[model samples]
Target: MFLGVDVGTGGTRAILVDRDGRVVVSEACEHQPIHSAEIGWAEQDPDDWWHAAKTAIGGVMRWARENGKAVESVGLTGQMHGCVMLDADGKVLRPALIWCDQRTQPQCDWLNETIGYERMIELTCNPALPNFTLTKLLWVREHQPEIFAKIAHVLCPKDYVRYKLTGEYAIDMQEASGTLLLDVTYRRWSTEVAAAAGIPMSWLPSLFEGPEVCGRILPEASSVTGLAAGTPVVAGAGDQGAGAVGMGILEPGSVSATIGTSGVVFAATAAPTKDAHGRLHTFCHAAPGIWHVMGVTNGAGLSFRYFRDTFTPQLGYDDLTALAAKVPAGSDGMLWVPYLFGERTPHLDPDARAAFIGVTASHTLGHFVRAVLEGVAFSLKDTFTLFEELAIPVEKIRLGGGGARGPLWRQIQADVYNHSVELLEAEEGGAFGAALLAGTGVNAWPSVQAACAATIRAAAVIPPTSAAAMQAAYPRYRRIYPALKGVFQA
Candidate 1:
């Protein structure tokens, strides 16, 4: 059996899979609410992640043992772009700056200016954003010099958990790509960028390819989580890369559109594909010897959740989606721009805020809900526009995360993209992908591709329900950002 664990934004999840890739048992433990002491800033306790991971792992292991399964290997995956700092003795220095934190714009500007914007992209294949790890580190250095002086190690969220489990400081190529401190083309840390950013290279972890053994569960971790001591832990990809692996997006021309709190449109590439404008991120793929380009929408399901929390806290997510389904397409000309947490992809503006345009007295709560949903779909289509410009082939589109769960969202995505989207038979997401990586490591399958091919199958395919309405609505949606750009800055 193979075990996979994902340290996510809200929780940690563990899954145990049998030799054939069948899921035997899965468990999740919710994290404490993320601390947001200031607007545009987000933080989480690394110790909390470790605790949640232990809970989930123990739960899954108990169930697996009851089912007569022994977990032979483990893989790890988690949210990307978090900055976790540690002291010389491996004690966490402070709360981690998670992916959604937006307090690093000044640092991003400094990095671009110091390294030269185009030159930075040339070195990292990505433009430094406020959410990237390096920018978060810079924010800490500038704002808390006392704490910065004590830093001895740095890790992304998952890698920090890996250290707790295996007593090793290590990271994978796919996760490293988001740090803005990696030479993605060569799959190693970039000394030039590190020197320019004034970050010490010695603080970085050892790099590994996904599916390679980076460490083994130590006696201490095994005691806490109930796994066998010395169980091999494979170097797993970040959540995005591992999720793509689970959805069979290993080869070029295959793509995925996933909507969690954020949305991402990912396409595998045979080689490093650069966007000279740095509008999209080109990162190393979990599958060795390949790369991927992805565009991000900072707020997708987040917009919907924000509305629910503010206006209809009593209603559940499914209830809101059902209400949204009752509304007509385009929400009767009402449009939503889901920039609630700033925007990524086409516009890397950290100050950009969300808006609801063309709301009328006649509009109902359902209309607002539908508008938010449509707005997210439209934002994701912006990536497709870039894909067309880059000539990145999109032979198949797979939907994952919140977007794949609902019939309404599936149809909405298909209409907006003007292409059919496939749903996987099992949508266990990043944890499942991590398990596949573990299976590949243990030779359960010869490669990640073979593991996915053997286990994953399309559950359904949804085609565009109405192409004309989406065609009409998208142009108006496209106009909202430009019109509000000035207002956002002010």
Candidate 2:
């Protein structure tokens, strides 16, 4: 058996997988809700992640022991771009500014001015964004200099948890790509950018490939998590990278559209693919010697969640989606802009706002709900449009996350993207992908691709049924954003 742990935004999940890639046991422990004392600011306690990881791992280990299975290796994965600072004694300096935090636009501007936008993109294969770790660190340096002064080590969320588990400071190339501090073309820390940003290279963790063993489980972690001390722990990718591995999106032309809290359209590439405008994020893939380009929609599933929580509290997600299913393809010409947390792909504007446009008295509640689903899909389709411009192939599109689970949303994605979408037979997501990396670390599989090929299989495909309607509506959807841009900014 191999173990995988994911330090997710809301919780920590641990899963045990057999040599064949079957998940034998899985457990999760939720953390406290993210604290957002002010708008556009999201923070979480790093210690909370450690506690949840211990609890989740303990549960899975208990199951493994009862089943007479021994975990051979462990892998770690989680949300990317979160800035977790530690002092020389390895204590958390402050609450981590999470990936969704949007209070660093001023810092982003400063970086862009200091390094030039194109040059910054040339170095990191991505532009400075509020969601990136470097900007969050810069925000701290400016606002909370005391904490910044004490920072002796820097790690992403999962790497911080790994530090607790193994007493080692390490990060994977794939996760480091989102830091805006990596020379992604070379897969190393960028001294130029670090210097310009007033950051020290020594503060960064040691970089490793996703499937390489970077540390061993320490005795202290073993005591709390019920694992044997000295078990090898592999460097795993971030949520997007590992989730792609779990979905078998490894080669060029293979793509995935996942709608979790955020939406991502990912395509694997043999080389690092750059977008001159910096719309798509080019990052290292979990598989060695490969790269991926992805576009993010910050408020994909969140759009539907907000609608459900705000207006239809009595209705569950399935109930809301069922209502959406009753509506026709284009929501009777209504459209939604899913910029609740500001836009990412195609537009790097953090000040962008959400809106419902073209609403009429004839539109019902169902139309509103269906429009939200289609709007999120439309936002994701922007990435596919960028993919075409960059000449990235998209021969197959696999669907994952909350959007893929619902029949309505899956078909909606197919229609909006104007392509057939596939579903996996057993999509356990990042933790499962981490387990595959763990297996690769121990030679249970020759490589990440082999582990995926042996274990992952597609279950179904949803073809585009309302392509013409969506194709027509998409142009109008495109127009809405541009027309409302000034209004949103105001």
Candidate 3:
């Protein structure tokens, strides 16, 4: 059996699976999110992610050992675009500049305008955004120049974990693509991007394919994680790349939809494609030569978290979703713009705040609940529409993430997106995707397509039912941002 370790911002999880992607055992360790109180900034200790990863992997390995399963390779997937700085001894300099940090907006705006937005996007297949690593580095250089000057190697959350295990300093193509320094067209770092961003090319780690066997666990790592010393560590991709593998979306016209801490609508393509408006991002595929265009919503599973904390403090998510079902579609003309933490795709507005639009005296908690749900799905549809514009066909979407745990929300996703939403029998989306790549890298599977065919599970599919209403409602949904766009900048 192979192992897949997923290190996310909130938690780390490890799963033991057979060649067919049937999980035999799995375990997770979740931690509290660390936040900076200076407003609109979030961070996590790299040590915390490592500890949780070890705990999860150790627990799963113990279970696998008890069950008499032999380990082969291990692959990792993680939250993307985080910036982790390592000192001379490979120790973390500070809390990671996490994917959600918004302090780099000014830097992003300056780079986007100064670097010639069209040329950058044409070369990189992505535009400057505050959440990406380049902007984070610029922010650090401007605000904490002293600390920025003393960096040894820069890494993402997954790459840092990989370094701890393998004693190798490297990142994979898929994750590196999020750094905004890599050449999306050439599949290497661009000298022009590095120079323009005022970053030295040497700060970047060596890049590899997601499935490349970078190294094995060192003795110390093995002792902590209970894996064999020579266990192969594959260069796994970012969450979206891995999730696409797990969802069988590596094929053209295939799509993956994840609504977890955030939502994403991603379509894999044989070639890199970008929206003219930069409403979507294109990244290197875990499938190597391929690329994936993605539209990200800043809030996805988070909106449900907000509602849970706001209304049903004592109720389970299932029960709360049941209450949401009591309300009809469209929430009786009520709309919600879930930009609680600003937005990514469609609107790069960092100052954008959230609101429940069109509230009236007749509205109840149920209405509010459902509107929040539909708002997220509709915003996700916004990404889907952009995918349509780019001509990256999305025939169906494989749904994953914590939000997929709720059946009602799953059904709502089906209705609002007006497409069939499918789920995997195995729960670990990103980790499982990583494992598929590992299997391919090791020649356990002839190709990614074959590995996916062996691993991806089609447990159920939710097809659209109320497409007519959603079609009528979508036009109104499209207008919410334009109306609010000016308000955010002011």
Candidate 4:
């Protein structure tokens, strides 16, 4: 059995998979809710994550023991771009500035000015964003110089948990790519960027490719987590990288459109593909010798969730989606801009806001729901537009997360993107992908690609039906953001 552990923003999850890649046991323990003392500042305790991981791992290990399954190897994954700093003794210096924290625009601007935006993109394959690890560190250096001075090591949220499991300070290349300190094209720490930012090279952890064994379970960690000591742990990926692996999106022409709290469109590439305008993110893929280009929508599923919670708390998601199904393709010309948390892909504006345009008394609640569904898909379609500009072929698009579970949303995505979308047999997400990496690390599969080929299978495909309507409505939807940009700022 291979074990995969995901230390997520809200919780820690442990999943055990058999040799054939079927999940044998799974357990999760939720962490304390993120502390947002101020708007745009999100934080979580590293100790809380370690505690949740222990509980979750212990539960899964107990189940495995009862089932007589001997865990062969382990893999780790979690949220990307979080900054977790540690002191010389490996003690947490402060609560981690999490991925959603947007308190670093000043720092982002400084970095962009210092490093040169175009040159920064050439170095890291991404623009300086507040959500990235290096920006968070800069925020700390500016505001809490004392803590910054004492920092001896830095890790992402998942890699911090990896340190608790194993006494090694290491990170996978896929996760390292998000730190803004990595020379993404070379898959190493960017000394120039670090030096310019006044960050020490020693603070960064050693980098490893996904599926490479990086450390072993420590005796102390084994006691708490119930895993045998010395068990090999592979350097897994960040959530997006692992999720893409789980979906079998390892080839150039394959793409994935996933809608969770946010939405992302990811495409694997043979080489790092940069967007000159710094609109899309280019990062290392979990699969070796490959890179990926990604675009993000800050509010995708969140739009629907916010609506249900604010207006119709009584209606479950299924009920709301069912109501949306009754409405026509374009919601009678009403469009939604899903920028509730600001735009990321095409517009990197933190001040961007959400709105429902062309609304009238003629619009019903069902129309609103359908409009929200279509709008989120339209927001994701922005990435496809960029992909086309970059000439990235999209031969297949797989659906994952909340969007893939609903028939209405599935059809809506197919129509909005004007392309066929596929569904996996079991979308176990990052944990399952981490397990595959673990198996690959132990020679259960010769390579990550072969492991995915053996395990990942597409369940069904949804073809575009109302493409003409969505295509006509999309141009109008595009106009809404530009027209309302000044309004949102005011």
Candidate 5:
């Protein structure tokens, strides 16, 4: 058996997968509410993640033991771009500034100014964004100098938990790419970029390729988590990287459109494909010897979540999706801009806001729900446009996350992109991907690609519907951001 652990935003999950990649049991423990003392700022305690991981792992191990299975290897994956600083003794200095935190815009600006924007992109294959780990470090340095002075190491969210388990300072190449400090072309830390950002090179963790065994569980962690001592732990990718692996997007031309709180259009590439304009991100793939280009929509599923919390607290997601199915293709010409947490791809504007344009008294709650659903699909389609521009092949599109669970959203995605969308038979997302990595780590399979091919199979495919109407409305959806860009600033 293989164990896959994902320290997610809302919870920590542990899955036990058999040799054939069948999931035997899975368990999760929810996290406490994220601390948002100020708008555009988000934080979570590293200790909370550790606690949840322990609980989830122990629960999964108990189930595995009952089934007379022993987990031979473990793989880790989690939220990317979080900044977790530790003191000399490895104690967390403060609450981790998580991925959605937008408090580091000034720091982002400073990094670009200091490093030269083009030069920065040349080194990292990405322009510094507020969500990158380096910008969060700069925010701490500027706002809380005393705390910054005590920093001995800087690790991402999952790596911090890995530290607790193995007492090691290591991170995977895919996770390192999001720090805005790696020489992405070489798959190592960039000393030049680190110096330019005013970060000490010693503070960064050692890098490993995903599926490489980076450490072993210590006796202490083994006692708490109920795993055997000295169990090997693999260096897993960040959530996106692992998720793509789980979806079998291992080779070039294969792509995935995943919608969690955020939406990502990830395409595997033979080489690092740079968008000189810095609109799309090029990062190391979890699969060794490869890279990926991705475009993120900061508020995808988030739009629906916001609507549910604000207007339909009494209803569930299935109910909302069913309601949305009643509405037509374009919601009677009403469009929604799902930029509630600002935009990421294309515009790269942090101050952008969400809006429902062309609303009328004739429209009902169902129209609004459908509009939001279509709007998220439209946002993802923008990435496809960029992919076409970059000449990155998109021969296949696999759907994952909440968007894959509903037929309405699946059809909306297919129609909006005007392409066939596939769903996996074992659609476990990141946790399953992590398990595949674990399988590779123990040589249960020769390579990540071989493991994925042996285990993953597509369950269904949805083709485009009302393609002409979708194609027509997409141009209008593209116009919304430009139309409202000035108003958002005002």
Candidate 6:
């Protein structure tokens, strides 16, 4: 059995997967979120991540032992862009700045206007978003320069978890790709970018590819997690990289659609290619040497969660989806732009707001729910067009996440994307992907490909069916964003 550990903002999860890729045992531990009382602030305790990870893993191991699954290796993937600063004694200096925290907008804008957009994009393959690690560091530098000055090294969320498991200082390329300090093309830290960001060279850890084994779990960690002490622990990537692996989108030209707390449209590329407008992000894939372009929508599944809370009283996802299925394509001219938490792809505005347009007396609650689903699908298509422009030929796509849970949403995605979307037989997302990386590390399989072949399986595929009217309505949906771009800024 391979153990995959995923440390997310709200919780920590561990899954024990068998040779056939089925989850034999799974466990999770939820933690509280911490934040600054001031405006636009969010933070999580790095120690919370470590505590939750240990508990989740220990729980999974206890269950796996009862289930007769033998532990082989372990892998970890975590929420991206968290700034975990360690004091000289390896203690967390402050609470981790989490992935979705938007307090660094001032730092982000300053970097963009001062350092210049083209230079940063060319260096990092992305804009200086407030969510990125560099921006978070800048926030610390300005707000708590004393703590910043005392930093020994910085690790992303997953890297901090890996330190607990292996007692090693390491990180993966894909995680570093989000930091804005890595020269993405060169696959190393950039001195120019670091100096510009006011970060020192000594603050970063040595980076590795996702599939490589960084070190072995120490006996102390073994005592806590109930795993073998010398078990190989792989240097896992951030959540998105693990999601790509989970969906079997590691091959070139393969595309993945993932929606959990947020949404992502990831297209694998053989060579590194940056989006010309710096609207999309380019990153190294967990698969050795390959790269991927990803466009993130900050609130897809979570938006549905909000809508369900507002409209339906205790209706589950299936009930809501069934209600949506009653409504026809395009929601009968009722268009909903789901930018409630602000848009991410194509338009990089955190200030972007959502609205329902073309509503009439004919539109019902079912129609509204259906419109939300279709709206999310249409938003994903915006990112898909970027992959097309780069000629990153995508045929069929693998779908995962809470959005991928319903057959209705899958069908909507196929129709809107005008392509087939297949589901992974294994349900766990990043956790399972991390286990596959661990399997590769332990030589449990000859390579990452072999592990995937031995374990990963497909569940279902939704193919694009009839919808000439919906296809025609796509242009109108595309225009809504442009018409509202100015309003979004306001």
The top-ranked prediction according to lDDT is 2
TM-score attained by model 1: 0.99
Off by over 4 Å in 3: 488-490
* Number of backbone collisions per candidate: 0, 0, 1, 0, 0, 0
Give the alpha carbon lDDT tens digit for every residue of 1-490 in model 1.
8999999998999999776668888899999988999878899999999999999999998887787778889999999999999999999999999999999999988998899899999999999899899999999899999999999999999999999999999999999999999999999999999999889999999999999999999999999999999999999999999999988898889999999888999999999999999999999999899999999998997888889999999999899889889898889999999988788988998888899999999999899998988999999999999999999999999999998998988899999999999998888889999999998998889998889889998988888988779889999999888888878454
Model 3: lowest-lDDT 10 consecutive positions: 481-490
lDDT of 1 at 314: 98
Cα lDDT, model 3, residue 254? 83
Backbone clash total, candidate 6: 0
Q: What TM-score number comes out for model 6?
A: 0.94
Candidate 6 per-residue lDDT over residues 1-490, each given as its tens digit: 8899999866899998877788888899987755756534668998888899989999998987787768888888988988999987789999888777777878989898878888888888898887789999888989998998899889999899888788888999999999988888889998898987778888888888888988898999999999888988888889999878877787776788887777899988878888768889899888787888999877677678778887786898778788889988888899888887667788887667788889999788888899888888888888988778877788778888877877888888888888878887775789988989888887778877777778777888778884575687789988888798777453
lDDT of 3 by residue, 29-110 (tens): 9966767777779888988988998899999989877978878898989999999998788988888888888888889788
Query: Residue 478 error for model 3, in Å?
Result: 2.0
Give the Cα lDDT of each candidate: 0.92, 0.94, 0.84, 0.92, 0.93, 0.84
Model 5 residue pairs with clashes? none
Task: For model 1, state the Cα shift of residue 175 in Å.
Answer: 0.4
* Residue 448 alpha-carbon offset, candidate 3, angstroms: 1.5
Off by over 4 Å in 4: none
Q: Specify the poorest-scoring 10-residue window by lDDT in model 6.
A: 33-42
Q: Kindly report which residue stretches of model 6 are placed more than 4 angstroms away from their true locations once superposed.
A: 33-40, 310-313, 486-490
C-alpha lDDT of residue 366 in model 3 = 81
C-alpha lDDT (0 to 100) for residue 89 of candidate 5: 100
Q: Give the Cα-based TM-score of candidate 2 against the true structure.
A: 0.98
